[model samples]
Each structure stands twice: as structure tokens, then as C-alpha cells.
Target chain A: MRILVLGAAGMVGRRLIDRLLAEGTIAGQAIDVIDAVDVIAAEIPATGRITIDVKASDVSDPDEITALIDKRPDIIFHLAAIVSGEAEADFEKGYRINQAGMSHLLEAIRAKGGNYRPRLVFTSSIAVFGAPFEEPIGDTFLMAPLTSYGTQKAICELLLNDYSRKGFVDGVGIRLPTIVVRPGKPNKAASSFFSGIIREPLAGQEAILPVADDVRHWVASPSAAIGFLMHAATMDTERLGARRCLTMPGLSVTIAEMIEALRMVAGDEVAGRIRREPDAVIEKIVAGWPRDFAADRALQAGFTADPDFASIIKAHIADEKQRVAQAGA
Target chain B: MRILVLGAAGMVGRRLIDRLLAEGTIAGQAIDVIDAVDVIAAEIPATGRITIDVKASDVSDPDEITALIDKRPDIIFHLAAIVSGEAEADFEKGYRINQAGMSHLLEAIRAKGGNYRPRLVFTSSIAVFGAPFEEPIGDTFLMAPLTSYGTQKAICELLLNDYSRKGFVDGVGIRLPTIVVRPGKPNKAASSFFSGIIREPLAGQEAILPVADDVRHWVASPSAAIGFLMHAATMDTERLGARRCLTMPGLSVTIAEMIEALRMVAGDEVAGRIRREPDAVIEKIVAGWPRDFAADRALQAGFTADPDFASIIKAHIADEKQRVAQAGA
Candidate 1:
């Protein structure tokens, strides 16, 4: 199997590459070649049995997209996108990279013509849903995104379904929840605090809590998100029928609950590192986001989420410990 | 107000043009100019007070679209599209014309810049919603189109909302139901039979009924469709907020109910001209169509529909009589 990962420099992309290297196969087929692409040069990890190529490429460029499509990788993992706050602030850049970039890639694949149907696993986000929900939104709710970033994702989802329906590509879009304890520095996304409050404290650093403790949101672990993408790439798409997109299963938790989980996992000292310095801008942005989802379709299709916030914290700690061990070695 | 109608040669477009001419105004403003465009040469009706320019142009061409945008018409009525059967048979042409064409027009409007936000009234269809509906599909149901035509319209709807939200264009999309008692001859559309059975019989000719009498579908008259377009063009869009597209109000009835209504309108002699010749292909296509819609949003926005199928039959008969009277005069 030949695999290609777009946005291979991002946290999820890098982790996914590591997982792929460790397994040495996807869907029981040995991966002989791997092409990892991003706007910034991606790191090429040493795999004894597999050929790896890491390159810097802009997905919005026609030539770049065409070159990648010409390689005709068996499975394409598209996980590249601008975060919410950045996309909202820079509208043209967001639309160009997120919307036009995805369209260009799809058009390139379609232009390849004769029976070149690749399994495309696209990572969408729960931001596609807005405020004023009926407790927990069902899998079949309307996509009336309140932000430009969400709009772009929703538009890409429509394109994925259309391209898949026409048989140009075998595509599956997984709408991921806010990834909890993202193993990275803080970014521009309003929901970045969802990860920061947990990640920073775990590393013995102070983190800011932007919103109220009672404000709830849907989330999944980084491992679970990676699992969703892997499953989507190999699952029986025939069961998806016309709806090619599915909202992945996630844990719903409030800020207070997350703090409680943090205290349980890392003791009082780590949990005390969180400062309640409220940010009105972040609060207003997060207010429009969906709090919970049913995700029954994804659950029925064999996708799973973290059992609880405590486990999520433990998983992050374990991942950090592994990174430290590798560095020491 | 300068009004532009893209598919000005079609049945509804021509009727809309006629309504516009007779009323001599839109949104209570006196119309100064009308640019009616289509692939074929559009006829320019003599409106003593208004200047009319009818042109032959394909909306899919970027140059042609740019030229239309350069004119900067205040209200743009974009109703151009290939029918469902044609789109299904010719996939490439469907995407090129229906999907890319709409995108080109939107891009052109955006390129005009300088705060040039035209009121773009787009004609969507009920085909955006597929089968296994909840008897009456709600206003916020997910769009899962079964046909390429439906997919194209659904994609356009997403684009419309995005563009409108971005302030590039003031747009409103109305998903018209199957037009019943059509004045013209039968076309290749799967739902053509819905109008054929009623139209041909009213003209004292035999028409085939391809499916079972119990099969229900949503419908509206040509005049009602025109009214929906006019209302959409002038309605205060602030009420729409983020979701710009709406399912227009229409009468939902089974074939048996439709025939009964026809019999009451034009006597049993006209109704008896129907022949039951089951067509498997059309039956399959029609089976996946939405049966009914809960268009409460459109109704609340002051969009009206024909009270019953009998009223729809009467409206068609009245329109035909007016056409004949104009010709005689």
C-alpha cells in the first residue's frame, strides 16, 4: 500500500505517521511507500522497510496538487486546514487555502480520469455546527456554520460527498470534536484553550481558562481522532450510502469536569496551575460552538472515543513520557 | 432597479418576466432596465416604460458571466440549470454548467469588489432532499441529494450561504417543488409525468401515468413559483440570519388526489384521457424523491402557495386562457 498524508507537519499528521510506521501496514496491506506533504517541510522518519518522501507543497496550487494526484497514492489522509480564529480574521487566505485548496485537489483527482478512485479520509470539525441546539445535536442536523472556518469545512464536506457520489473518489469525511490535550503550543483557534488548560498544566506550566467552568463542549483524545481517520480509510464505505460524512463519537465535558479530571490525574499542584483570567473575545467565539452531539452513525460504524477525561489526561501523560524517553535514548 | 434573469427563456423565467413587466416594479421600486439572458435568444417584450435587453449567453463561460456582473444589475435572478434526467445522463456537462457555472458567477460578483453586493435570487429544488424522509421533511433536515442535479443544487446552496455571509452577495435560495400542470410539452425530467398526466389530459390528449397512484410528491404552480422568486428577491434577508436557503411552500398530494382535483376542475372527460403505462426507470427515480416538506420558515417569511391541487389546475387554465387572449388581440 502507498500512503500520502497532507498536512503531515501538524500534530495529528505527525502522530498518524508514527502510528503508521509502528504498524507497518494499513488495512492488512504492507505500506511500501509513504509521501508526506505540507506547506512547511515535513520530517521524514526512518522506517527500515518503507520508502518515505517528505516535501513542502501548497495544496492550493494547481501544479502542486496535480503532481501529488499523479502519484496516485492508495489512501490520501487530508488533515490540512487553517484554525478557526486565523481563518475568521484572514478571510481570503482561509477561503483560498481551505476551500479552493480542497477543490483543486478534488478536481486534480477527477482530471486523472479512468478509474482512479482513491480512498480519501478527510478530517472535518464539530465547528460546522453553531449555537441554539436541542441539547445534543443529532447526526442529521443542518450545517449552518457561524464562522468562516466552519463554512469552509461544511463546503468541503459537500464537495466530498458529491465527488464520492460521482465515483471520482472513494471519500469519507469524519467530523472530529475538539481534540483534548493537543500536544502542542497554543494556537489562534478559540477552542485552543480546550487543550491548553490541560496540556500546559501537565507540563508544570500555568495556563489561562478563557471561559466559565460550566461551559461544555464535545471532545476526543488525539489517539481517538487518529483512530477515526484510520478506520474511515479502511471501513466498508458501502454502508455509508449517500451520506459520506459522519460526526465521530466524542466525550462531552464541562470546564469544571475537565479540571476535576486534571486534579485526579496529576494531583492538586498540576491542577492549580490553571488561572481563571477570562477572555471576552474567546468566550464570545466559543459561545457559538456546539456543546454536544449524538454521533450515533459513527458509533454504529465502529468508531470509539475516550472513556472519560481522566483517561484522556493519562493518555497525554503517557505520550509525553514516551517522547521524553525517546529524547533521552 | 435593474433586474437580470439568467435563464430567461424557460417557462418560469418567461412567466416571471411577464409578471415583472405587468407589475412595472419590484420591491415597490420602479424598474428602469431588464437584462434577460439565456443560452438561446430571449424574446424582449414591449414594455413602453421599461428598457429591456434580451441576450443569448451561456452562464458557464467566465467572460459572459463577467460581462453580466460588469453591468451590475441590482437584482439577479439566477435560474439556469440542466434538467435532472439530462444531468444524470451527462455527468460532466451537469457539473460544468450547474456547479462551475454558479461558482463562476459568484466569483465574478466577488471580483467586482467596491462593495458591489447584488441581490442574487437563486432557484434551488426539492431534489436536494432524498427518500426515507419523516413523512414531512423539516426546514433543517440535512441535504442528501440522490441525483447529480440535486447534488449540484445542494452545493450551490452552500455557496450561496457562504457568499452571503461573507458580504460578497446578498443571496436567497428557494427550493421549488415539482411544478404541476405545466403549460409546455413533456420534457425528459423524471417528474415530467407529474405535469404530463394533468396537462395532456386537460388538452384532450392521453398521457401515461408511470407510477402507482399512492406515490406522493410536493408541487406548486408556475405562478406560485414566480411568486416565490419575486418574494425571495425582495424579502428582508435579515430574518434569514446564517441559513439563506429555504424550502418554498407547496401542496403535497398523491397521484390519486391530483387526478381527483383535475376531475373536479375540468370534468371526467378530461381526466379520463390518462393511461397507466408503468415505467420502471421513472418509478425508481421518482421513488427517491421527497414526498412532503414542512416549509414553516418560508410560510413565516410570507411566501404563499396554491391552497390545493384544484386551485393549481385553475391557475394553469387561467394562464393558458390569458396567453390565447393576448395572441388573439
Candidate 2:
């Protein structure tokens, strides 16, 4: 079946495109082709008969979004959003891209009516859950977002449910945890340090730890995130019903455990590259995030993840090695 | 303190306007005129230096919302929303007025920036909480809105919390229970029957009960809804912090209790006007709404309601008598 991936240039987006184009099947139907979009022109994965358009376009632009939808892809993976830091720092840009962009896309889909009811898989974030959280946050936790980015995501989730209920489209919003070992250069998100501490050190570079070791966070590897998205795109709607958003399963661990995992994967030498420089601002912000989460509903939905922290580290190491070898010679 | 009341032409809105102007004090605040708006010209509470503006303008228009904000009133009671049934019947109209209208007002407030950060009191609804709910839905219950109107309210609540957290504005969302003993002709709302059977019979008219007697619902009086708005406008936000939206204290009872209260207030002769006409469609929809709710947080914050169902019926009878006398004279 035809598939479209928005935010194709981003780390998770890139990985998802790779996975979908490489013999990915949903509900036993083979994915024939993939069309992807990014802010900058990039290469999209395409096989012999598959059509892949890797175009540069802003999702908030009505014409751009409409043009992408005109292809009438069977599934749309909406991964476009301003990172958390940029959203918090730039209010207008945050609302425009995050809220308006999603609104325009959903409206466009609804406008297509009868013949088109694409399965929409939107990548939301754990930021939807804010401070004073109950321990072991369930899939049904109330969204009391503390940031503009989170607020935008939460609002989109509501819209997805309403649209899905109206039979305008089949939608699923997957609230992913911080993707650890992101395997790339650091971005503008406050939580970028989450991946940086692992990724930078693995690449034989020093990375700063901005918060205390006791700071806990929920996280999943890139592979797991892609799996969550794929499962969401093909899952039985009868199980999800009108509540279309699901918090994907994640491992909740302290920063110290992350360092321990790093040591195991890349030896103590790589782990030694992490430098701690505490900042109360970052610490306070991190404190507001949930340390533990209960994703029982998502887990039961036939989506799986790395069983433990060690497996996540091993997967990252293996993936990074492949990237390293590809770059060499 | 200057107070602005959006949707002032609505039945509950007008009642609140009259009460605020007549009392000259709410939670110890002094006299103020009410700002009103609707399709038709509204008779606001007073006219003086308070500068009451009663205009016919669509609230969703950015320009109109901006003009309303120009006054920079100290307290803004935002009650303008398309009623549930109409909202459900017309999808685009629901999103335009309820969702987009709210966004326009909020964006206007945000645009004011440092110049104006008025206390915004938003009236939400019990529709935000849908079925399979815990017996007593607590403050932390997830928002599983079953209708378009409820989805809009839930979306607005997220924005309210984010804006408040960012210090852009002071905002509070109060999820009000269904207002009982309404003084009006029966409308199309599925929940209209909840009040109709009691309200019509008291007014010496026949009313149809479309659902089973066991169908439970959370309820508050018109006076309590007004109280919630006023309390929300004046309460200290430090306690609420990031969690700004609250489910206001309400009485949870079944239809049987509601009819009994009507019987006790106006005698069985008036109650005899009630007729049962069970509708499976309405019964199924009503079943998805939360029967009982726990508002411990709001109650602890000092917002209250009628102590029992008897008080609610008494208040309705008192209000209905005044209406009949005024119409006769």
C-alpha cells in the first residue's frame, strides 16, 4: 500500500522511512511505495515500481499539504512538529506549525470524504503529561501539558479522536517517550541531552549532562519508536475505538542507569566521556516530567519494545556501527 | 473590579449578569457592569461608567474578539459556545464557533502580552468525561470526550493550562455539571430531557422523558454555575499551579431523584405532567456520560454548590415563580 511520511528528514522520520520501504507489511499487505516530506530536499527510499517523492515543503502551508495529499497515499505518517525548546521559546511559530499545520492537514483529509479514509499515524510526545503526575502514569492519564509544544500535541490528539469518530479518517496518535541514543547530532529540544549523553560518547566525543543523575525519564530506542508507529498505522480500530491516542510503552530509568548501560555497550572509556554540569532550570523542568509510566494498554495492543535498558544499548551500538562503517571508505 | 461576560445573552449568562450587577459583590469584589454579545441585542445588567457593550457579533472573529479585549476588563467570564446538540448536528459550525472561536479569544489575550493579563474564567462541561468512567470521576480522570463540543472544551483546557504556565495570561477552566431546572422551552439537546421533565412540568406543561429512570447524571443549579465562574475568576492560582482546569463540585443523582424533588417542590399534580418515552439512541448516548464526579480539588479551593437535590428544585421553583409573575404583569 502507498505510504507518506511527514518530517522525513528528522532522525526518527528517516529511520521510519527506511523500515517501511524495506519489505514492511501491514495487516499482511506489503507496503508498495513511500512518499516523504522534509523542510529540506532529501532522498526517499523507493523500490522498482514504487513512487517516492522526497519534496521540501512546509506542512502548515495549505497548498503544500494539499499537494502531498493529492497523491492519495493509503497511510499518512504525520511526524512534523517544532521541537520542544523552539516551541517554548517561540510562541507564534509553535502554535502556527504545530496546531495550525495539523488542523490544515486534518481538514484537508476530511474534505477528501468518501473514497479516501487514510490511516493517519501521528507521532505525539510524552510532554503531554506535565507536573504533579501520579506514579506509573497510565495510558489514560489526563493531558495537562506544561509547554506549548505539549499543548499543541494534546490538542491534535483530541482532534484526531473527533475526526476518527466522525468517520472522516482512521487516526492514531502515538505518544512516544524520549528516543534515547538518537544516533545523530543534538537538536534544539531540552531533552536532546537524553540522546546526546549516549550518542556523543559512543562517537568518541564528550557530552554534558545538564541535570542530576537522579533525574528519571521515560525513553525508547529509535527501533522501538518506529515499531510503535507501524503498529499504530495497522492496528484494529475496534480495539482503540474513539480514543485514538495511545502512550507507547517505554523504559523508565534514572540518568545513572543510562550511564551504566553506556558502559556495558561501549566499555567504560566511552562512558567516561559524559560530563556533569548541573543547572537548576533544566533540573526543575525535568522534575515536572513523569519518571515512570504505565503503558499496559499499548503493550497489550501487540506492539513490543526492547525488554530492558541493556537491549536498547546493544541495538544502538549495532546500528551506529553500521552507520560508522558506511561512512568509512 | 470590571467584569466581562461573554455569551451574556444566553439564559444562564443573563441570569449571572443580573446577579452580579444586583449584588454589587462576588467573593468580596465590588460592583461592575457586564459586557454582553449575541446575534440579537442583549439587555445587560447595568449601564454607567462601567461601559457595558451589548453588540451583535460572532465571537470567533479575531477582530471582534480583539475589540472585546480592548476594554481589558479585570474579569472575563467566557461562556460563549454552540450548544451540544447543534454542535453535534453541524460539524463545521461546531469547530468554527466552539474551537476556532475560543482560539481567537485566547490568541487575542496572548497578543495583549504584558499590557493585559485578565483573569479568564472559562465554562467547560461534563461532556469532557465520557463513559466506562469510574463511579466517581476524580480531578485526574482522563478526557475521553464523546462529542464534538466536549472535544473543543478539552482542547481549550490544554491551551488554558499552557498559557497560564507560560505567564501569558491567568486562566482557569471549570467543567460544569449539567445545569438543572432550566427556565425555557425544551430544546434538541439529548440531555435536555434531564431538565425538561422537571422544568416543563413545573411551568404547567407536558414534558417527555426520553431515557430510563436509572440514567444518572452530574448536575448543578444555574446559581452554582454562576458561582463557579465568579470563584474561578477570583481564586489564587498558586494552589492550582500547572493544573488549572477543575471539575466543579456537583450533585450526582439519577432521574428518579430528580422527579421526586420536583414532586416534593410543586406536588404530584405538577409532576403528573411528566411522561416517559424511552429512546434507545438517547439512552445509549446518556449512558456514556459520567454518572458521578468527585471535585475534591475544587471543593478544597472553596467553590461550592447546592447541598442537595431538594435545594436545586427549590431554587428552580423560586426562579420560575418570578418569571411567571413578571410575564403576567
Candidate 3:
């Protein structure tokens, strides 16, 4: 079986590629080739067994998307999108990539008519739900995103279902929660602090906490996110019916819980690296975000989340150790 | 105020145009130019006081859409769309007109940067909510359209919210219930029988009832739908906040109730023109439609529905009389 991974340069994409290389199979079928493409090309030497092509490409371009789909990979993991901050700052770019990119990809696949429906696994975001939702938003809650980034994702989710209904593509959209302990420098996303507070302190560096300790948010570890994607790619979609999108199960934790988890895993000194610096702007934005979700459908679908905040922190630490060892090699 | 009406040839569009012409004002501003365009040109003679241009144009064409936007009408009533049956049968056409058309229009409006935001009144549909919803689908119920047309409308609603949020356009999307007793020949839509049963009988013609009498659905009069459009055009959008789309109030009645009302309004002889010809295909299709809605938001926003099924039949009869009078004149 062949696989295509868009946004392969990103953290989740990289880890997914690594996992695929190690497993060498999906849905119990031996893997043959993996075409990994992203806006920023990734560098990876392929194993002699499987053909891997990591290249730079813009998904917003219809022709480029068509060229990519011409390969007819058995499973296509679409993870490319403008980040929330950039999408909000630039409306045109947000729709072009986040909204239109999905359209172009779906159209490209549809153009290859007649029994050529491939499994297209798309990663949506919890941002799709804005304010005014009940605590622990149920599976049937409406999508009233407050941000352009969220709007784009919601629109794509609709298209994914419609296209799949028409038999053009076998699609599954998973709305992912914020990824905790991201191993990267802080970017402009207001929620970036969610990860920075965890990742920075683990590296013996200072981190900023812009929200109150009691403020709650939904999150999952990077490893859990990859598992969700894998399960989405291989799961039986017949159970999904017409509703193709599902909010993946996530750990709902507060800043205090996260810190306590950090202290338990890395000691008091490491937890002390986090400094309080409340920014009203970030706080207001985060307030509108979803705090928790009723992931009964997702859990029933056989997808799992980290057991607790401590498990998420432990997973992040273990992944960090692997990253450091790889860099050293 | 200058007004532009897309899909000016449709039943609701024609009625909307007529109402605008008769009223001679919107938001208490004196009427001015009205550019009426549709895929099929509508013949509407201006009242001599106001300038009216009715022409044939495809909204799917971006250049044509830009040209229309170049006029910069203060209020744009976007009522264009492929009906549910056509959209489902023709997927590409559905996306082109229902999806891309909205995108192009929004993009064109955005291109006219710096204080060029127009009040875009979009006509969405109850089709956005499919089956498996509660008896009365609330305002916040998730949009899980079972049809491609519903999917397209749902996507446009998201775009309307996002674009409005960005201040590119002041938009209001009204999710209209099915317009009952439409003044037209029978069409291929499964729901066409809903209108036919009332319209054909009232016109002293035989009509077919394609489903069981117990089948329930939501519906409103043509006049009520026009009221929705006018209210959407003039209402204070400041109250809309981030959520702009609203489910317009409608009378939820079963087919039996509809026929009983027809009998009361037109006498048993006219109602007796009805023929029971159950269609399994249409029954299956109509079964998935939303049967009711909780229009509390729309009511608070001053949108009203026809009082009852009898009132709806009376309104249809009144409109038919006017049409006959106009044709005779």
C-alpha cells in the first residue's frame, strides 16, 4: 500500500512518517511508497525497502494538488493548513489554503472517477467550536467558530462529508485538541503558551503563563494525535455514516493541573521555571476556546486519549529524550 | 439605497423583487437603483421612480461577479442557488454555483477594500439540518446536511459568518423553511409535492400526494419568506454578534394537517382534486428532511412566521388572485 502525507514537515507529520517507516504496514497491508509533501520540504533518507519522496509543494495550487493525487495513494493524510494566528491575520491566505486547498484536493480526487475512491484522512481542529457551547460540548453541538482559522476548518469538514457522500472520496475528519508540550519555539498563536509552559520548563528554560491557573482547555500529547490519525486512516468508516467528522477524545486540564503534572514528573525546580505574566488579550481569546468535549462518539469509535495530565507530561518527556538522542546521533 | 438581487428569476427572488419595488425603501432609506440578475433574465419594468436593471448572468463566473460587485450596491440580496434535487444530481454544478459563487462574491467584496462593506443578505435553508436531530432542532444544533445542496448552504453560512466577523461584509444568513404553495408547475424535487398538493388543488387542477399523511415537515408562506428577507436586510446586525445565520420561524405540520387546511380554505371539492400516489423514493428522501425548528433567535430578531396552516393556504390563495389579476391586466 502507498501513502501520501501532506504537511509532512510539521511535527505530527514527521512523527507520523517515522512511525510509518517503522511499522511498514497500514490496515495489515505492507507499505510500498510514502510521498511526503509540505510547503516547506522535509529532509529524510528513505529505507531501502520503501520508496519515500519528501518534497516542497503548495496545496493551495490546484494543479499541484492534482499532480499529487495522480499518484493514487491508498491513503492520503491531509494535515497542511495555515496556522490559526496567520489565518486570522490574513483572511485571503486563510481561505486559500485552509478552505480552498481542501476543495482542490477533493476535486482532484473526484476527477479520477470510477471506483478510485481513496481513504482521505483530514485533521480538523477543536477551534471549530467557538464560544456559547455548554461545558463538555456534546457530539451534536453546532460549529460556530469565532476565528477565520476555525471557519475554514468547519467549511472543509462540510465539504469532506459531502464529497464522501457522493462517493468521490472515503473521508474522515478528526477535530484535534491543542497539542501539549510541542518541541518547538513559541509562535504567535495565543494558545502557544499551552505548549510553551510545558516544553520550555522541561528544557530548563523560562516559560510564560498568560492565563489564570484555573483556566481550563482541552489537549492531547503529540503521540496521541498520531495514534488518532492512524486509527482514522484504518478504521471502518461504515459506522461513521454521513457524519464524517468526530471530535477526538482529549484530556481536559487546567494550568494548575498541568503544572502539578510537571512538578510530579520533573520536580519543583523545573515547575518553578514558569513565570506568571497575565495578558488580558490572550486571556480573552483563550476564554472563547472550548474547555472540554463529550468524546463519547470518538471513544466508542475505538480512538483513545492520554489517561491523564501526568501521562501526557510523561509522554512529552519521553519524546523529548528521543528527540535529543536523535539530534546527538 | 442601491440594492442588488441575485437569482432574481426564482419564485422567492421574484416575490422579493416585487416587494422591494412596492415598498420603495429599505431601512427607512429611499429606494434607488436595483440591479436584478439571474441565470435567466427576469422581465421587471421599473416603477419609473426607481432604476431597475434585470439581466441574465451566471454567478459562478468570477469576472461577472466582480463586475456586479463593482457597482457596489449598498445591500446585496444573494438568493441564488441550485435546488436540492439538481444540486444532488449534479455535484460539480452544485459546488460551482452554490459554493464557488459565494466565495467569488466574498472575494470581490473584499477586494474593494477600505470601508466598502455591504449588507449581504444570504438565503440559507433548513436543509442544513438533516435527520436524527431533536423534534425541534434548536438554533445551536449542528449543521449535518444529508444532501450536497444542504452541505453547500452550510458551508456558505460559515463563510458568511467569517467574512462578517472580519468586517469585510455585514452579512445576515436566514435559514428559510420550505416555501409552501409555490406558484409554479410541478418540479422534480421530492418536496415539490408539498407545494403541488396545495397549489394545484387551489388552481382547480389534480395534484399528487407522494408520501404518507403522517409525514411531517416545516414550511412557511411565500409572504413570510419575503418578510424574512426584508427583515434580514434591515435588522440591526449589531445584535447578531459572531453568529449571524438564523432559523426563520415556520409552521411545523404533518401532511394531514396541510390537506385539512387546504380543505378549509378552498372547500372539499378543490381539496378532493388530490390523488394519493405514494412514491417510495420521495418518501425516503423527504423522511430525512428537518420536520421542525426552534426559531427563538429569529423571533427575538423580529422575524415572524405564518400563524397557522390555514393562514398559509389563505396567503397562497391571495397571492394567486393577485397573479391572475396582473396577468389579466
Best of the candidates, DockQ: 3
DockQ of each: 0.69, 0.85, 0.92
B-chain TM-score for every candidate: 0.97, 0.93, 0.98
lDDT of 3 by residue, B292-314 (tens): 88899999999998999999888
Q: Which is better, 1 or 3, measured by lDDT?
A: 3
Q: After best superposition, candidate 2 residue B9: deviation in angstroms? A: 1.2
lDDT of 3 by residue, A227-293 (tens): 9999999999999999999999999999999999999989999999999999999999888889999
Per-model fnat list: 0.66, 0.89, 0.95
lDDT leader? 3
Query: What do the candidate models score in CA lDDT, each in turn?
Result: 0.89, 0.85, 0.92
Which sections of candidate 1 miss by over 4 Å?
none
Query: After TM-score superposition, what is the CA distance of residue B263 in candidate 3 from its true location, in Å?
Result: 2.7
Q: Model 3 off-target regions past 4 Å?
A: none
Worst 10 residues of 3 chain A by lDDT: A41-50
Instruction: Report how far residue B109 has shifted in candidate 1, in Å.
Output: 2.0
* Model 1 per-residue lDDT tens digits across residues B1-329: 99999999998889899989999999989999899999997876677999888999998899999998899999999999988878988988998899889989999999999979999999999888775677689987888777788888988988898889889999999999988878888987778899999889888799999999999989999888999999999999999987899999999999999999999999999999999999898888788888888999999998998899999989889888888898999
Worst 10 residues of 1 chain B by lDDT: B127-136
